[model samples]
Target: MDAMTPPDREAPAEAPIEALLRRRWSPRSFQDRPVPDAALASLLEAARWAPSCFNAQPWHLIVARRERETEAHAALAACLSGNNRRWAPQAPVLMLAVARTTFPQDGSPNRHAGYDTGAAMAQMAAQAVVLGLQIHQMGGFDPHRAREAFAIPDGFEPYAAIAIGYPGPADALPEDLRAREQAPRQRRAVADFAFFGGWRA
Candidate 1:
């Protein structure tokens, strides 16, 4: 581990779960290191295997490696919201996750497109952990600007902007974000959301 690397912020799971799942977390601070091409491909490969409704496979990623795709990376950075733009640009890689709103088999609306796309990104996040990397998916972005910048087709919708790289020390981030980076991870109890047989209010 590098001297600048932060300690693992593992989740305190109520039940046993995959070690990777426990280790996975989104960090705003990233080291100024390039992610290898092979590792990026592995992340996409993991996403490719995610199951989608009717096998539509609507998820698509527009990748921009800061050192490799300098112009594109800057353009993508411009699409982020002010808050995210602060730290996200520091990441070595940036990506825009988009989803096709219609099925390829038929030009009909696919309500699950966004849901399926999310699943794919989830897989990518796990794979990042495996590669000693982390991804922070941000909804705080200008979708309209992204669409214009990328010339995204009408049938596709920009879902999220992703920042990918090795985690860095919390102190690397701005004071506010540094606090969040060092904060303990929290989640709602399983009983709060899981209803065995019926909905509970």
Candidate 2:
């Protein structure tokens, strides 16, 4: 239940998959330990390698480590919605994922910008699992406030707010969250979505 023995929230995959993918799950309880700079660098590096359309690499991460940037971290936390503000601020790191909506070269709209940003975060999430860390990405935030707080520029959109740190006991969370945290992981069967050469309604 402590950081040394965090709960196992691995996904019950229907088919065999890499342990890294199976092991990753978002958690609201994070330990007090600060993520090391090296580990942070490695995570960003993993994200940097994610593939993107036209190799545009349109993602940008605004990171705030609680210990290192206390004020900045607080400012970022203030942008979270009430539900997220309850648990997300406990993590040692907070990040805002931003996407450049326009192609830099031509100033034209890039429809895949958000998709590519998500791919980058996916890679970062995998890296977190590898580092014995966990990340919970949240859509519950005020993007306009985040833009004002961070001075995010024009043509850039805030996609998600992320809380990252080592996992902690489910009991550390409030009663409701703890219940949800310990609940079984669920996913649709592959057959439910995958089809053979044609779409199914």
Candidate 3:
């Protein structure tokens, strides 16, 4: 398992979790194969079902496969952070997740737009594992560049760039990324972050 893999579902746990959640990982290396349309639709469908504030479901995804949209893929790659640019370019599918900051029904401000978008991404990640694929989501990208490149409409915010593909050998990544790939997964205790009562004094 790589650093991104979740805890084993079969192992004893404080609470039960889905096996797909345990298997999902955000890996830097990926096999150079185009994602099939059916698999892609499944991933999007999972996202479609995510819960959202007032069921607004603000997430709007723009996906480009390496072989199908070469120029657009390159354009998206260019908008990524320098570190990500190195490894993400090889992914077969690259996507931009955008959020609509207002309700479509009456054009009211949506304070939970970001939160809703996150829920959608979480669904897609889990679905990817079910499809034997992995998705690495990154915040390191120029929003302005992406907006201009993709002609993003007003009131819509570009949230994250996602690289989707089948996991490849870690050795294919740069030496630094390879080391990070094999590192132990770390997380804070549930008690540390999840407060049950009033804020800790």
lDDT of 1: 0.91
Ten-residue region with minimum lDDT total, candidate 3 = 1-10
Q: By lDDT, rank the candidates, best first.
A: 1, 2, 3
Q: How close is candidate 1 to the true structure, as a TM-score?
A: 0.96
Candidate 1 has its poorest 10 consecutive residues by lDDT at 1-10
Q: List candidate 3 segments past 4 Å from native.
A: 1-15
Better of 1 and 3 by lDDT: 1
lDDT at residue 8 of model 3 (Cα atoms) = 29
Per-residue lDDT over 131-185 for candidate 1, one digit per residue giving the tens place of the 0 to 100 score: 8899999999999999999999999999999999999888888899888888888
lDDT of 1 at 92: 96
Clashing pairs in 2: none
- Candidate 1 differs from the real structure by a C-alpha RMSD in angstroms, to one decimal, of 2.0
